[model samples]
Target: MIYNFEDLKEIVKSKVSIKRFNHIMAVVDMSIKLAKIYNADIEKCKIAALLHDICKEMNKEEMKKICKNNFSEDLTDEDLENDEILHPFVGAYWVEKNLKIEDIEILNAIKNHTLGNKNMTLVEKIVYIADAVEITRNYPGVEEIRNLVFKDLNEGILFEAGKKEKYLESIGKKSHKNSYAMQKSIREEIKKKN
Candidate 1:
């Protein structure tokens, strides 16, 4: 089940909507650029970006089913109910089980793209930031964050994580444990650099 890049693209395209597919392509483009800048594995970034949202279009029931089946111990009832938060876990599992992509970096990148984790590899950071700052993404402070990412990945991630936490609070949603751990890890990294 090893797919060439084009095969992967086609599979992703068929699985997601046109808008979702466009976002995925933008993420792929941004990922490659960040990978080149950060000296990460470009192919892994490409693969991770392509499959990051592969299960985004799935119905909530199906996503919940997948999460329950594969990540039952790792995810909570709230996590499984939140499609926005649930897709990454399902995406990673789907990519591994269906697409036969066994690369741990790629799978973790896909899994961590949504909420992020305590210790993200270079490839994971590339995919995570690229998904946020891709050219098509237009948010209030996205331009500033995008600029910050190219200059310093850790700072950019820290900023984005803070924003995500605030946004979730604004919407009356609790930030996931992984996001908090990631922010803590990135903050420590920034502290070391300073």
Candidate 2:
């Protein structure tokens, strides 16, 4: 079904975990603004924002278990490693199998919100950008990127990913070796007009 505000609210009520729901709401608000500005699919943006982290609390082991049972075999090893990166793919599966959502756009947005795919659609970019810049977020330089999101999406995307990479380095986390997909995505987006 096409999701509007009330429908989103209902879905949130039914599907959201208590601790994460507030974050979801924050993303939803930001996503709506982005959808308006970017002329994206509003319902898909809302649904994707609402469901982006549906499996976030799952640990790597749990994620693996779920993926083993539910995931298609076409996923590569990098995709498996990145399973712990974000839960949007698992979330999409849950949202479909449990929540009865069947829209391909919504599923794609949820699937791609993290470590975004190359040549992302408007809906995918809307959710990814919105999730990064939501008000509940307090990462360094978020306000700068938040401002840039309205003015120059590609710049904001590059800046945010760069910021995240730096933050990971600072926290002594291993930075992901630049995946070929990310390189391709960066190159594709670099060519786009704001």
Candidate 3:
């Protein structure tokens, strides 16, 4: 895909609120740094990170309608069934349809950045962690996860996933099945390593 950073940034800035736009920029910076350490494609990382939340402000009904075709199969039943939480899929689909990205890995990273899947690729994992620990984000234990990012990508991913779980419970929201499965898989991997 031909990804022009300026064009992508303009499109994103035009669509999202200032706070979200800043978050997107932070994720882009973090993604690029993590991509270098993790040996991911930097250009793809840039595009995916910038566009990850492009549809965050979009209405759920519109997302659901477009997702009928663009996001039907890849997302979990939890995602497909719940209109409220389908931003990741909607973002991925909208970018592909509008930008002609033509890179499934980039699209996949955007799709899974919110609550990652067990089968996530390196690019996906980088984007997910970057989104969680981006400099703009202020949360408990975020510093530890930020430090762990380049030092240990797997542990960083697990840490962020666990933090996300706690945040969900505190807010009285249920995590997607992918979040649980991803956390379980990461825990097992960390255990095996230890």
What would the per-residue lDDT of candidate 2 be over residues 1-194, giving only the tens digit for each residue? 55565765676656557768888889989999989988887878887888888777767776766666766453545656766554776877777887788987788778767666666778887888898899989977999999999987767777787787777689886444332355468667676733
How close is every model to the real structure, measured as TM-score? Answer: 0.95, 0.80, 0.87
Q: Pick the candidate with the highest lDDT.
A: 1
| lDDT by residue for model 3 (114-178), tens | 87888777888888889988998887899999998779999888877777788889999777777
What are the Cα lDDT values of the candidates? 0.91, 0.75, 0.85
lDDT of 1 at 151: 96
Give candidate 2's whole-model lDDT.
0.75
Best-to-worst TM-score order: 1, 3, 2
**How far in Å is the alpha carbon of 135 misplaced in model 1?**
0.5
Candidate 3 Cα misplacement greater than 4 A, ranges: 68-84, 187-194
Instruction: Write down the RMSD of candidate 3 (Cα, Å).
Output: 2.5
After superposition, which runs of candidate 1 have C-alpha atoms over 4 Å from their true positions?
Answer: 1-3
Best by TM-score: 1
Candidate 3 lDDT score relative to the true structure: 0.85
